[model samples]
Target: MTDSNMNSHELELLIAAWLDGRLDDEGSHALQNALRTSRAARETFRQYARLDAALHDVADTSAMLDLTKLAAACVRPSSAEQSPTRAQESSDTEGSKTERRQRPFMQQMAKGSRVKPTSRKPIASLRMTPWYAALAVGILLVAFLIRGFSVDEPGTESIADLSPSEKTINTDAFSKVSLSKPPAPVAVLSSVEGVIWADSQLEVGHAFFEGESIRLEQGEARVSVGFGAEIVADAPCSLKFLSSDRIQLHDGEIAVDVAPWAAGFTVVTEEMDVVDLGTTFTVSVEAGEKAETTVLRGVVRVHPTKIEGEPRRGLLVSEGQRMSSDGKGSFVNVPQDQDEVQKQLGRLDFGVTGPYRPVDLSNTGQGLSTGDEDLHWQVVAGPAGVFSEPQYASVCEPERGYLPNDPDVSQWISTADWRTALPNAVYTFRTEFALDGYDLATMQLFGRFLADNGIESVRVNGNPVEVQSWVDNVKYQAFGDLQFRFVNITGGLVSGRNVVEIDVRNGMMRTGHVKDPPLSPIPNPMALRVEWYAFGRQQGIAQADDGVRLWRRIRDSVPPMSMLSYAGPEI
Candidate 1:
């Protein structure tokens, strides 16, 4: 390539990089130099950046527009399409002046709406010179190529599948843009278990941002997006962060709960757009397939994106309704049984293999003894357990699920000093239990923990395993009886003795955030108690035979207290 051609190609690459926020410090400096030296570079940068900003802040109805449509809308029509008459030319000129007049007002409106502004210098004018027209067409064409748009392709073509010639041309043309760097996080990783695959390794405290692609190779993550949306994405899936309120699921399944403040949360797929209607829902998509949207609560709007006709329509999917589309873009709706849907989705299925008997591992040295209160105290008391004594007069009592079927199991242990010291603390309670061999098919482990907002995970034989919250209504009962379930750990178990460690992290106290009750002398301690049951894989667990597990059948039944819990704040 000639020097001028090489410079032009480099400028296009830099402009593309700047538009995607993928430009490094060096590339950014180069981009600035090109903008100063080349008017075409400046125009191209402004055009791409503005279109990107518009798409990023698009409203509910218009969000489904793809990059090609957005680019076409942004670029001015060719000169051949322009008016030939003098009056028409004057009208076009006047329209251009009107657009220039509205530009500042548009910027002000974006600012007032609290949307982040585009990182671009002000455009000189909306006037369309022949040079600008040619530059606009080049910018739009490069935008389509860089954004993964393909022509004369068979079926769906991934970015990785570009032909060598196409790849070489695009690579040299847009070499400045780095597709690997993760964007600044608009959310925090609140809870994570298993393995996550992305361009970068992620941790619980790590932050993620819009436009970042995250894949769950194995495991699960519950990310808190902003303050109001909680996203639970299961592994073996691909997800792209479109914005704080929207994500695109290329594959796998994700469940999202949106608070009222963050209404209109959306999940995008190739075939459809699943928009939240102030509700909780799950969206699933697989390669070469349509997206399945299941509404667990509230409502969702499933809009077809790749329909053949213009003005594509959407259907409302209410709670207990399921909406799905085929690869050919045909959408279907059907009434679904919530329980059956949960089972199919693997929401409530544990996939446990065998039978179980309660095993106790407490500091008091009890081995499944039926009537021991002090031994229970050793498990429930101390620095990491609940407050030694009840701190408040409320209908809430300590979770007695792990206690023996005896009245004396309710003995109070004493408050530890650390109860009031740690605001958001993580406390782990471990139990080393013996197992003869890996003969059992499945093991169901249950444990209790106290926290305002907490999730638990288990390490069996020093390897982290998936643990689900046993209590269904966890959000409503923040301080109520909460338990964690480690279901079907047959794979993690070994032939010899195994150790299970449970880590529970507590949330901030209510006194600081939402004042609802009187202050107590001491805060509740982060307590944990664990029990396990196992059976042979061949025999399979029986639902009616409740004696194998005491708490499984009656999880919702409140403790048969000779005393009603005192009615007040249970802090």
Candidate 2:
């Protein structure tokens, strides 16, 4: 029936048909149109959808009633059934002929059966009594209450709600103690991916209460427990929430970062308990194996939970220490393996600056130059002095003010003019340095490329490095923002006179947005200059007194840019 002609009862019947997957295309189209036009219709549909889900859950859980038998009982005819009419008999005869034509083998097999066959059509229609109808409504109401189902107004759905088709109950929301435990939320899932549970359904931004457990069958999750403590858990793990400050890791690996406020945070493994004393640590527990705890920062106290009659002494593990436990909960201090330690620490940028020397090519009296700011050519440091003398470049361009592109790429020019500089072409910044007895195998080149939406393709002694790894985001102005990368120059380094070439695809003439018209090279001038460039043995680089020590100081880390960055998809 058309939506305009569908009465309230007809709409409800259509909903039931839709729930039962019996609604035809035309009826479904009409229902969708009605939902768009009427708010009440949408609400009613949501209520019925939730009701259907609850009914399925009930059917799966309850053993007292067989749903298939109940369906048969509803359609079964009583002894008062009337005989088939002549027209009905003719229809049945036609249906039998059609079935035979469709499947002759099945018809032949059925014809040989000893048991008498019943017609596909029922002998009589069963009418529902008022009591039966009322009982169904009462059951639906009770189910809705038990499921805590409610119809939300338009545009009120939570951001974390995925889709109704994949709906799984959020056990965290239940207050019924057996199914849902703990009175308050102890943690919140900050982010999650490919995560499904063996025990309960979990979602991002959902508050997790204590006494609840989550099994990470696969995927990863970053959970924030207590004040500032965040736990990044990988797949094949199970975690039981004990309290705001404590949890039991039944299996798998988890990296926990506890702030000062959450100093007493604890993670319980099968072997022992790892108590965080304002630290960042990783606890890995394998089934039937000893639990390993690695302290990334600060300190932790590992205590044996399954000790004998005597009191188990808590072992204080300081920073850079690793403790391995025996299956029976005896933790022994073991030498920390750097490679193994890095794996447990995840994406830490460890300190690497050391045993090498650096030569500054972009300095005064040094070989830094340019032919013409307007010309598109490389200004190599050589004879004839066509390349400009090296001068200090400033990130704070007070005189020139802000160059408009994206607000994030705003920079200052300490010496050169911010505008009317660098033509819309590749500007090669070449620098040469000498090397001696220093170990080139352990050495790496690290520096920033300062240009507005520019800087592409880097080559060392004619060998090309992976631009994706060196350049953080090529589609945007990152190297221009003083962001440095520890470039791996494998086979690019030699004994002396090593040539490092950097190609700059200056985005002076083009608008960052793809939709806008491209500007001509004359009017669109971009400011370009390298703030700093340095190369030496990896050990010669300076180390900062903080976090994971790395070879170079990364200025400003930014996310990667996309190639198909149009206004919308399919454009």
- Residues 1-571 of candidate 1 have per-residue lDDT tens digits of 2224446668778777665546787887777777777677778778887887655434211211121234434554444453222212233344353222222232333354543323321122111111222333344445667997543321121111111100011123334332211122245455567775664566664445435567788888766554246678888888766554577788998887766556677788888888888777888898887779888888888888878867878789998888988889778897889887666445622123222222333432223232223323322212344334423111112332222222222221212333332333444444566555323332333333322234445578889875553321111122211222224343466645767655554433211111121121122334333323332222334333322232222223222221121111101
In candidate 2, stretches whose alpha carbon ends up further than 4 angstroms from where it belongs are 1-182, 199-201, 339-571
After superposition of all CA atoms, the RMSD between model 1 and the true structure is 27.0
RMSD to the hidden true structure, all candidates? 27.0, 26.3
Model 1 bad stretches (over 4 Å):
1-184, 196-199, 341-571
* CA error at residue 276 for candidate 1, angstroms: 0.6
lDDT of 1 at 246: 70
**Residue 38, model 1: Cα distance from true site in angstroms:** 33
Residues 182-264 of candidate 2 have per-residue lDDT tens digits of: 02235556567788767566555455544556778888887755334678888889887766568888889988877665577
lDDT at position 53, candidate 2? 80
